[model samples]
Target: MSESLLHRCPVVPVVVIHDAAHALPLGEALLAGGITVAEITLRTAAGIGAIEALATALPELHVGAGSVLVAEHVDQVVDAGARFVVSPGLSVAVLARAQARGVAALPGVATSSELMTAVGLGVTEVKFFPAGLLGGPAAIRALAAPFTSMTFMPSGGVSADNMADYLAIPAVPAVSGSWMVDPGLLAEGRWDEVTARSAAAIRAARGSGAFQRVV
Candidate 1:
């Protein structure tokens, strides 16, 4: 896995596009805000098309797939041009498939046992899913205590209000959430709003620069 994958952007927009056509404009908006990474989720049927559109049209954006639950999903996104794969939980099959496909994989780990399993698989990075409910930055700090070599990206319940807090942790290089790319904003075609929120997120990340570097 590329160590710099999570360091490309401080806030990776976790996007869910209901319409594939919205993908390009959204990617452009993210770029306008100085964010260089996006995680287009597979929660919707248009996910594959969205990933392909962004990957083909906006090669500058480090586009990745989120909410990947199976090995087949990994293959689908990779073929669709995803550079990375993110799951809500650890899955040996998903990790193996992603490795076989030669793409970076970030499997979520909310427990020490799960993290140990990831380490066993030679994973150097992980996503701390449902970060807020899992004790937020405090949880990551505790987890990082034993796994000194591992780095993390916190997602779920993460927002601008507490994003800086998460970035303060030495183990977290970035955080992922949907605030900048809200479903309502996408449905309304509010590209400017997306850009504004995305810019704000970038500023927040910059302010909390302690963990901005790759671990």
Candidate 2:
């Protein structure tokens, strides 16, 4: 796992690209805004192509594959040049596959049991998914109480308004979200809007003063 890639950007753009052509422009916009990571989800048909495109076009950007639900998905992303892999939920098969492949896998965990399972798999950093619905910062804080060594990347419901709150938690190392880089905007080829939104979100996350308070 490349810890530097995970920490380089406070907010990772969780993107679902329907067009492979839009990948490069969207990636450039994100990088321009001081964000170096992009997670191209396989939720769309063109996902694999988009991931390959971004990896080729934006070598400086750290590209990852998201919504990886199966073992084959992990192989697909690795072959597509994904630097990391993210799953919506943790599964023994998924973790084992990722570990065997030697890629950084961030499995989603929303409960204490899930967190424990991820820890058992030797994952130190995890994704606290559906964060807003799962009690958000309060839930994370409570979960971190017993597992202080574990950190999280809170996704789902993360927005500029509350990004600081999530980052303020000592258990959170970073966050992943789609609010900054809207799929509609990217689909519509609105690169400028995406760039601006990415910049705003990055500023909000970094300006929160939370990174300095990590304990």
Candidate 3:
């Protein structure tokens, strides 16, 4: 897991694995499809094991722990070989824990105050969570005016359809979603479907035209 991996691609697959057994294969499929970063959310009991398995199996791919809301969750992910951590909301305690552990943390910020707090805490890159419900690209554009130095990884409701919209905003560093890694397909053991979707998402993001300007 490399800190720079998230920036290498515009989209990071937000994954939720219920079966730890499928972790390695699923990660390989995503990586084979040109998607290098995977965010395994701790939304299920299998998430930690899945992260561990994927990290061990796909040494070249970047694996991040997401939905980390507590300080302890940070420790758990760090111990499980997570290269970075992401939270749905900014928490001073959570950020402090990640900083102390020397792990890259992308805390979520939905408002100016939250963004300011993250900036004050030395966080330049954050997750614009629930992006669609929060006004999507327009909202992020407005926030970027005062915080020109800040960057974001907008997640939640982010898909191929609106990835271009988010990438057009200078403030957004990247975007993430589970659209590439469909849970239904995973549950049905459809690795081929997952790989195809992942490939399509990677191509769609690359073809969006906004990445050229940013790069």
Please list the residue runs of candidate 2 whose C-alpha ends up more than 4 Å from where it truly belongs after superposition.
Answer: 1-5, 210-215
Tell me the TM-score of model 1.
0.97
Residue 154 local lDDT, model 3: 84
lDDT of 1 by residue, 92-194 (tens): 9999999899999999989999999989889998999989899998889999999998989999999989999999987888899999999999999999999
Worst 10 residues of 1 by lDDT: 206-215
lDDT digits (tens) for residues 1-215 of candidate 3: 12443466677889988999989989888887878888999999999999899888898888889999999999999999998899999999998898888888888889999988987887788888899999988889899999987888888889878887887776675789988787888899888888898888767766766456435
Question: Which ranges in model 3 have alpha carbons more than 4 Å from their true place?
Answer: 1-5, 210-215
TM-score order, best first, reads: 1, 2, 3
Which regions of candidate 1 deviate over 4 angstroms?
A: 210-215
lDDT of 2 by residue, 144-212 (tens): 999987888899998888888988876676888898678789877888888898888877776776445
For each candidate in turn, the TM-score is 0.97, 0.94, 0.94
**Strongest candidate by TM-score:** 1
- Model 2: how far residue 115 lies from native, Å: 1.1
In model 2, which range of ten residues has the least summed lDDT?
206-215
True-structure Cα RMSD, model 3 = 2.0
